[model samples]
Target: MARITTPLTNTEVKQAKARDKEYNLSDGEGLQLRIKPNGSKLWLLNYSRPYTKKRVNLGFGKYPDISLADARKLRAEARTLLAKNIDPMEHRDSISNHQKEKIENTLLNVAKKWFQVKKSAVTPNYAEDIWRSLELHVFPYIGKRPISEITAPIAIKTIAPIAEKGSLETVKRINQRLNEIMNFAVNTGLIHSNPLTGIKAAFEKPKKQNMPTIKPDELPDFMRALSIASIKIVTRYLIEWQLHTIARPSEAAGAKWSEIDFENNLWNIPADRMKKKTSSFRTVN
Candidate 1:
């Protein structure tokens, strides 16, 4: 006849102390609390591997952390796996690896990878602004989640708060930026398809508001105000230069004396300074 192993009580587990060497307190069929001389208690489940006759021990966790109740729950799960011809250790190991992969491939991690290539196409200051926007508005919400899990619903929920605050334009820009990041993930094989494709449809389309241009009637007041404005003289000159040359603030500010043709009355700007980077010659008064 086979000897029967009795189940251990929670009191026995708590009162048990480490001795001269390692000792085990068995809780029935397979669960055991192994106490070491170093004052450590570990939960182990001794079981026979399915198919093979050899036995092995599967570690649950340390005592107090795993607790007696938790150890028994794990032991019962291991027995269920054994009944189905699966190795408990291997199954647990597989789940652990998947979780590790998800942590490694989070949204913020993939965004950094995308930004490395994207930064080369833009100015350093613009790149910094782009990253700052992500850190402020997006990262706190879903950046830690895996890139593969960024579905449209989750994305819509994230930016909805911004939209509610009457920043629809900001929300639109964020959507476009996020779409680019997700596309990069797809191209790099991080995800199969871009789940953010239809996310824009989930929100209201931003209404078009044209840039505030001075009307003909308002030109006199504008010039009169500019003449007495509190701004610096150099700033006044640059604004007038921008008005005349029909150039953006950045383009007008970048003008150099070398680009001026005194004889021809032409401002020969460099292609690099222009927004379109093609038109270089402009007639200036």
Candidate 2:
């Protein structure tokens, strides 16, 4: 059992010397408190390993910031860990790693990683758009900073300037993308909090742009013009499918013969081929 020493007083703490100077406590445990002229106090615990008998310095409290009570608590904890046959340094490192993992799961980092993984899955043009919004508008100010460091105020600083420029639609689209990315980050353990949640006026609902359509009266001229322009049969058929079935351009161009049933004149596009959500195949006659 360790014996108690006289209580450490402030003047005694001040008179403590550094390097060559030492303020030795009565317990004779070689527990030294070194005080610099600047009044900064630091503790060093000297002890030997059980089997090796090698001397080692266990670092402890620093100055007034680490009160005597706190230092005692820390020492007690260290002793407990040592009793359990654990190295105090290794235990501290494990705690630090846990804390780092917790912080890494924040919304910002998770979103960035998610974007990196999914970005390649999108078409080149769409990927460019997503990257452009994030890099130009959001990443410059916030990318390298830790996600926990990004408060709602900081997030607003990253986005509000773009929102102010009458680009509500653009802002809305970016916000929605940001929302999905952040949500995914949460699901995958990247972020604990979604900064987008508390932001007001951070987004406006996007107005649906009516798709372009060609009237039936214009069809003959259009087909004739396309034929005169020497469009290939495949290209012509692809365009016709886009017009009739309201399929996206990529979907029409990328359709395979294997997906078409000639007997029923029905084309079945599998869910994987869809540019939109949902996985069920789409059919067109």
Candidate 3:
């Protein structure tokens, strides 16, 4: 028959004097109050591994620091793990490691990592714009949060104030940059999903405004003013080309001789050069 030890009480533990040697007063079911020779009281739990039957002692902290009730709650949690054949110590270590990883993988850290890759692909000025926007708008609220824990509501809330300020265009650009950053996180396995996905629906849709242009009668005066203006010959030609071809300023500026076919009277603007990808050709007549 197994030796049965009497369960210890808080009063009994308090009244019991510490001896010259360290001894544990049993609270039954693997929980004990260990009294040391120096009079310090510590809570400990002794349990066996389900697989190897190896006995292990797990500390539940100091007696006064962790009350009797708290110690029992911790012991119960440990026993629950034991029943499932899981080692409580190892489970606790895993949780600790996960929290540490989360702290290290903050949104700012991941965004910086993603920015390093992105900066190389864009011009320095554009990269500066992206960083400035993130620092001004996104960082204040959620930058320190774990990337994996940033949900759609968090992302929406971060940008809502900017949208509400009637900076709809700025909001759109920031949203695009955030989406790209989150996508990079997903692709790199830092996060499982992009929280900024479909985030545009949260904001009011921006109304489209057509580019301001001069009337047909006003164009001759505009051209006459351009001819007399002390501008470079190339600038004069660029203005003429824009007026005649209705090409955007960027398209007109970036035109090369190779793209023009004199025989066909056509300018083959590549998809990359055009504002829209499908607009590949323009009549040059």
**Lowest-scoring 10 consecutive residues by lDDT in candidate 3?**
271-280
lDDT against the true structure, each candidate? 0.88, 0.67, 0.87
| TM-score per model over all chains | 0.67, 0.51, 0.67
Better of 1 and 3 by lDDT: 1
Where is model 2 more than 4 Å wrong at Cα? 1-57, 60-95, 102-109, 112-141, 160-167, 183-192, 203-209, 221-237, 262-264, 275-285
Q: Between 2 and 3, whose lDDT is larger?
A: 3
Off by over 4 Å in 3: 16-21, 204-285
Across 80-108, the per-residue lDDT of candidate 3 in tens digits comes to: 99989899989988999889979998989
Q: Number of clashes in model 3?
A: 0
Give the Å error, residue 104, model 3. Answer: 3.2
258, model 1: CA deviation in Å? 11
